[model samples]
Target: MMKTALHSVSYAGVWPGQARLGLDDFLERTRNLGFDAVMLMAKRPHLSLLDYDADARSRLRQRLAGLGLKVACLAGYTDFCLGAERPDIPTRELQILYVRELARLARDLDCGLVRVFTGFDYANVSLDQQWGWCVTSLRECARQAADAGVNIGIQNHHDAAVHYESLFELVEEINEPNCKIMFDAWSHAPVEKAASAGFRQEGGDLVAAVKKLAPYLVHTTVADYVHRPRYRYQPNLINYICESDALRAVPLGEGFIDYKSFFKALKEIGFDGYVAYEMCSYLRGGGSEENLDGYARKFLDYLSAF
Candidate 1:
């Protein structure tokens, strides 16, 4: 059966006005919210490598066991192309080391997955070089994670492999058994919307895209969004210049995303994996404890149907 997990980013205070909860408190809240598992942000104010030592990991594992909450995955932030312009900085190596430590931490926490990202495109570097960096770095991360019995789940959040097809190709090129895809619907919803408006793009159909990636998908994150239009007033011409619509996060089942098709596809594939809910941006309602908890509960209610 599919399971529901809450991501700590929602309450990590990373976003403006979002309530920040300590790691322990977040875990307790997850249990209180009735989520089957929890996805840790794996950084400061939560599970920072510097803050969590060997003893800390032990205590955290025990706490989760006590709460009957499973660790779904550790969210690892990485950008392989971040310092491509300044190769002297060893950014790729540092990120690899960061992921390595995360793998060790995941092992210590008794978690089997560590979610990562490919790099964003840099102005000075060619896409080929950035792709190579991501592939090489992810391959190494996967090799190391394998030793710890952890898998590296590459999320389609960054520039590299942002498209589902490219993401699939990237994973295939990485060629690591332990490396898998952490697919999400919000990432593809925009593309599908664009495709409907005569924009050419792959994976425009959410169901087909999900089926295409179902074999490699090990984890997925759920979030809903609605586009808010923006325009720049051109006083000189007495007209307004249209700009891209700003996406605002909203409660599940309330946004423009077609979660019915997305979840239906996942069900068709028998994706019995973690479907994590994350509030990673400024939300529709204020980010108070009451609103956040209400959103979280609504997500559970939304998933109960599937």
Candidate 2:
């Protein structure tokens, strides 16, 4: 059966006016919210490597067991092509080490997955060079993570290989057994619609994308968003200039994402992994604890249909 997970980022204070929650409080809130699992943000104000020691890991593992909550995955932030111009900075090596340590932490916490991201496209960096950096770094990360019985999930959040087709090719190039895809509808739905239509469209071929990545898919993060059009006043021209639409987060099933079709495709592929809900952006309602909890509860209600 597919499980539901709440990402700690919902309470990480990354978005404007969102209140911060400590790790312990986040875990308790997740359990109280009726989620099957929790995705911990592996950074400051959550589960930073510098803050968690051997003893802390043990205590956390026990706490999860007590709450009947499982650690779905550890969110790791990385950009392999960050310092492409400055080769001496060793950015790639440092990221590899970070993933390696995250793998160790996952093992200690009894979690089996760590979510990572591909590199962003640098201004002066060639596509081939950036792809090579991600491939090399991921291969090493997968190799080390396997030793701890952890899998590395590459999320489709970065510029490089953001498309499902290119992301599939990138993963094949990495060619690691433990390296898998953490595909999501947020990025692809917009891209697919833009590529197909001359302008931005409402929905995309979520079914096809999910089917394509189903085999390698281990986890997925879900969020709903609505497009709010923006325009700049052109007083001289007596008109307004249309700008790109701004996406605003909303309660599940309230946005333009074709999640019904998306989830149907996952069921067809027999995807039984954790489906995580993340409030990583400015939400429709104000960032109060009551509003956050209400949004999270709505996600569970949304998933119950399928």
Candidate 3:
């Protein structure tokens, strides 16, 4: 059976002066919220490499043990092509080292997976070069992760290998036994759109997409969003409407994402990985401890139904 885990990001305030919780409190909260496992956000205010030393890691491991909680995975925030404007900076190297260290941390924490991203495409470099950078970096990271007895789950949250075909090719190019995809429905919304618009390729629709990607997915993140339309007033053009879509995060089962279909496909594939819930962006309700906990519990309720 697939396990349910919560991402620390759901409680880690992203905005200034927002709700903030330390790693310990976050873990305790997860336990209180009735989750047996958790995915730690590998950054400050929660599992930052800079913050945790040998002693700190020991204490965290002990705490998890005491609480009877498991570390599902370590979510690493990385963009391999970050410093493309300055080739001398060795941005990819730095990111690879970061992921390597994260793998070590994952081993120490008794976690099997270290989640990562394939860089974004906001650089001046060509797509081929960017893809090459990510592939090389991920291969090295996967090697180190394997050495540490950990696996690397390349999340489809970045532009470097965003599409399913591109991501599959990238993973094949890396050719690491320990490397796999951390597929999520939210990241494949564009493909769903194309499928809805009569694109009939195999696995073009959401259900088929889930089935096609299931074999490669080692982990999946869950979140729901509802689009809020926008309009721009134009004096000359009779109020031109904005083409861009705005999405607001909502509690599970309350958004536009057809998670029932997605979950059914996952079940059909016999997915045996962690299904993590995250509230990383602006939520439907205000961000407070109570609201966050309420939403988190609601996720559990939603998952139980599945």
Where is model 1 more than 4 Å wrong at Cα? none
Report the Cα lDDT for residue 73, model 2.
97
Highest lDDT against the true fold, candidate:
2
Instruction: List pairs with backbone clashes in candidate 3.
Output: none
> In order, what lDDT does every prediction score?
0.91, 0.91, 0.85
- Model 3: per-residue lDDT, tens digit, 82-145? 8867878988888889998999999899999999998888736888888888888999999988
1-306: candidate 2 lDDT, tens digit per residue: 579999999998998899789999999999999999999999999999999999999999999999999999999999988997788889988999999999999999889999999999988999889999999999999999999999999999999888888888889999999999999998887787576766644333888788788779999999989989999999999999999889999998999889999999999999989999999999998788889999999999999988
Model 1 whole-model lDDT (C-alpha atoms) = 0.91
User: 15-120 in candidate 1: lDDT tens per residue?
Assistant: 8899999888999999999999999998888889998898988888899999999999999999988976576899888988999999999999889999999988
TM-score of 3: 0.94
TM-score of each: 0.97, 0.96, 0.94
Best by TM-score: 1
- Candidate 1 vs candidate 2: the TM-score winner is 1
